[model samples]
Target: MVELQARSLRVKIAQQWGSLGLPFLLVAVVILFSFLSPVFRTQFNFLSILRFASFIAISAVGMAFCIMAGEFDISVGSMMALVGVLGASFVPVIGGFAAVLTTIAISSFLGFVNGIFITKLKIPAFITTLGMMFVFRSLAYIYTDNVSVYIDNDFWLYMGNGRVLGIHFPIILMVLCFVGGYLMLRKTPFGRYVVAVGTNAKAAELSGIHVDRIKIAVFVMVGFFVGISSVVISANMGVANPGLLGQGYEFQVITAVVLGGTLLGGGNGSLGGALLAALILGSLRNGMNLMQVSSYWQQVVTGSVLIFAVAINRLRYTLMGQEA
Candidate 1:
């Protein structure tokens, strides 16, 4: 009886360690950074890390949905750039609030286009999104006349930089996105549909699930999140440069989601894991800056992390006797 109990405890701990590994890794990174740089442990610097993490976390939540639906969006980085430039351009003519709304609508429409091409046209997601990436990025340049749109409005600035009771607005918005995503994915019927479609589309379809519609809806959902991210990014930078707004953003968010233990092939994911991974990434970047590491090396680190994450997932699948 004692042996059986001990085995059960071991299994429980193993399960927990598998699920909560990223948080532990995050804690370890924090401890290491704190030791390396006193500023790493400071409240102000901590808040700064949160601020940076918020942007990626918001997008990662949406990206997580896409991955969970057995699809991915490589165009997110370019989509963000296009939305940011477009949103910034409208700020002067339509006012800040209207501009924001317009950008989100455009983002949704673009996502809808992507869904149509993939679902209706039967194009693979990899090809569709990869093609859209260049198309959207080019459009941003064309629409903006290859220049940056400068928004000097105080309200726009406040959206990115303001704090309420010492908590930054972006951070607040990030938390809200995460909570909303978590509830939707875990509680709602739509969430179940997403998982079902991802886990096995043929089975889900035979079971009366609208797999195509769900995929489209998820694409639209992620577009909305990307729109929000574009606004925050534009506000933070004070300008929406077609070339710079969201460069490399897709990789960062993808890395965060994958590192958080989301499967690349879809079907399984955790928003909480993505959130923690985002924090870990943000913390690492900050720590590296504090250590005077060159900015170029960050890209190398990101690439390495992505490779490592995919490998880890593959190993997990192998151990579980499942296909990755």
Candidate 2:
């Protein structure tokens, strides 16, 4: 029995390691480059990386939950824009915390509607979220009048720029968010239900899981996170410009989530991996800029990495199936 248990432990360890090996390898590459570049470890560069990581990391945490719950929300980019606009407009009237809460509440409502369409109406998640993405973008533009609104460095604004130990407040908040998210996904019954629902919705339902409720919860959670991200990011930038603020955010968040070894098919994800992947991407981008890589070249490199990473995941799953 001891030998049997030892073998099982070894296999489990190997499987976990295997899942994360690619992203770790990518990180190793960045570390190697940092050694060659004197600029990589500078305080400025490090803070810059954190600033970038905080924005995407917040959204990725929510994305992780949604993916684990057997759904995806490509609409987060637009949702971020929505939150930014709402927060900027409402903060003056309602104060920072209240304004933020109100915006998140609205975002959650929209997400709940999406969930109803997905789970109750039997609409596909990808299609519904994609459509909502456009709708939100349009709403953001119309509501904000395609203009940027700058806050008066008030409470809402300060949250993004405030610092502790030379790190921005948003970074601290993002770390807290990750810690909270990790607990929710790993230490709670909701975590089990998330994975169970993702793996087999019908089976989970038959086993007494409230699958629809779980799906709605996941969407609402995702919305709240996206809203949180928008609040921090818009403040950091000193203003909100929907067109510029949220441009390509969905791609960035999705890229980080998938690169972190989250199963694209759902039912598996890890905050540790997501955090690491965010760092890796931030480092790579910062490193390239230091190396004087052109913006077009940066896009090429980023795109290539995402494509190759996803392809590798697919191949890994295929081989596992064969081995089984």
Q: Which regions of candidate 1 are displaced past 4 Å?
A: 1-14, 296-300
Per-candidate Cα lDDT values, in order, are 0.89, 0.83
TM-score per candidate, chains pooled: 0.93, 0.91
Candidate 1 local lDDT, 147-219, one digit each (tens): 9999887777787888999988899999999999999999999999999998999999999999999999989
What's the CA RMSD for each of the models?
A: 2.2, 3.0
Residue 173 lDDT (model 2): 89
* Candidate 2 wrongly placed segments (more than 4 Å): 1-23, 315-324
Q: Candidate 1 at 53: error in angstroms?
A: 1.3
lDDT of 2 by residue, 1-324 (tens): 997887676666546554567567666867776797898878887888988888999889988889878799999888888778877898788888888778778878888888999989999999999999999888889998888877764777767888888888888988999999989988999989998898888999999999999999999988888888888888888888878878889889988988876787777667777887788788888888888989899989888877776676566555444221
Model 1: colliding residue pairs: none
